[model samples]
Target: MATDPIEQFQISNWIPIEIGGLDFSFSNASAFMVVTAVSASAFLYLTTSSRGLVPGRLQSISEMTYEFIASMLREAAGSKGMRFFPLVFSLFVFILVANLLGVFPYFFTVTSHIIVTFALALLVVGTVIIYGFYKHGFGFLKLFVPEGVPGALVPLVVAIEIVSFLSRPVSLSVRLFANMLAGHITLKVFAGFVTTLSAFGLAGAAGAVLPLAMTIAITALEVLVAFLQAYVFAVLTCMYLNDAVNPSH
Candidate 1:
């Protein structure tokens, strides 16, 4: 029987590798997270180790990545957003690396899991809440009130806006997770068609080629999707931060 490609996404079981009745087994997701962090560190180290005026290829790529995030922040969140350049840039690179790295053979996509994405989303939303409250005091509550609305309707309007504000993290996280999950599953399903069709005759062989082609094409597209997904995640973060810093926007 053929394996279900979707089942390949399962999180590894917790083993009883116990220390004083506490179970801790290295999971596939955890391994990927470690790998993602190490890979990011190594990339940064190698790229910046030579502080020469003349640029190297790796250094150029790293610089470009940083500038890209900076540009996005300035464009989306404005000059006030520069204060967050470091955080936004780091986030963009980290997520980009984790996503692109998962495309390799025998590797897991940490971002495909809801737990990981939701955690990240929570951090973004949490930062917004904390920063907004600290910066604006009780005026942060005014985020839910539109400027042009009548005082009579303010209560009902605020209630709706509050729900919308709370939904940001879920919507943000689910967007990335759902896209990555769907992309990988679609790739796997197309690849599987090649296997199933090859068992038939020449027409089957002929037909099998199409799915193989599609799989290859989608793989390339998924690479683009990976980058775009990372971009989307970072941009949304900037937008959320903007709403925090300048809540009236």
Candidate 2:
């Protein structure tokens, strides 16, 4: 039987374990997350280990990635925000690699799941909230009050601001999750058509050509989307952190 296209995304337990009525199975999704992290680390390590005077291609890529995040942080969060360089950079690299990995034949796309993306979004927002309160104390509350609002409108504006602030995680997480899920599903559907059509005789083989072309095109587009989604996530993270760093704005 031909494999179901959606079955590619089904999570399977590689090592099942239950403790105190809690299932803590080591799943394929979890495995791929580890793979993504390890691959990213290895890439960074190997690319920068030499530190040659004339940078190799890998070194140049590593350096460019560093500068890109640095520049993004500086622009969004300012000089003091550079303190969170490690945090932002790691998030960027991890998401970017995880996305890129999913482009491969058998890799799982972690960010395609709402739970994973929401957790990441929560991390970003949680960090901002914690740092904001810790750094600015009561002053962090000013984030909800606009500078030019009249006293009469302050209450209404503050309420609106609070709702908008709370929605950040939802927006951020859904954007990434929806994009990855849609892109992958579309690719799988087209690829499956190619396989299904090719199973017939000569006419079927000929019919598979269109879907094959679409599959290739979508594959290339997904690669760009993977990078774009990662960038969007990282940039928004920086912008949120900036609010924590400078809450008055």
Best by lDDT: 2
Across 92-180, the per-residue lDDT of candidate 1 in tens digits comes to 87788888987775578989899889999999899899999999998887788889998899999989999998999999899989988
lDDT of 2 by residue, 93-151 (tens): 99999899998877888888899999999999999999999999999999999899989
Please estimate how well model 2 matches the true structure, expressed as its whole-model Cα lDDT.
Answer: 0.93
Q: Could you tell me the lDDT of residue 248 within candidate 2?
A: 89
* lDDT of model 1, residue 128: 91
- Candidate 1's TM-score reads 0.91
What is the lDDT of every predicted structure here?
0.86, 0.93
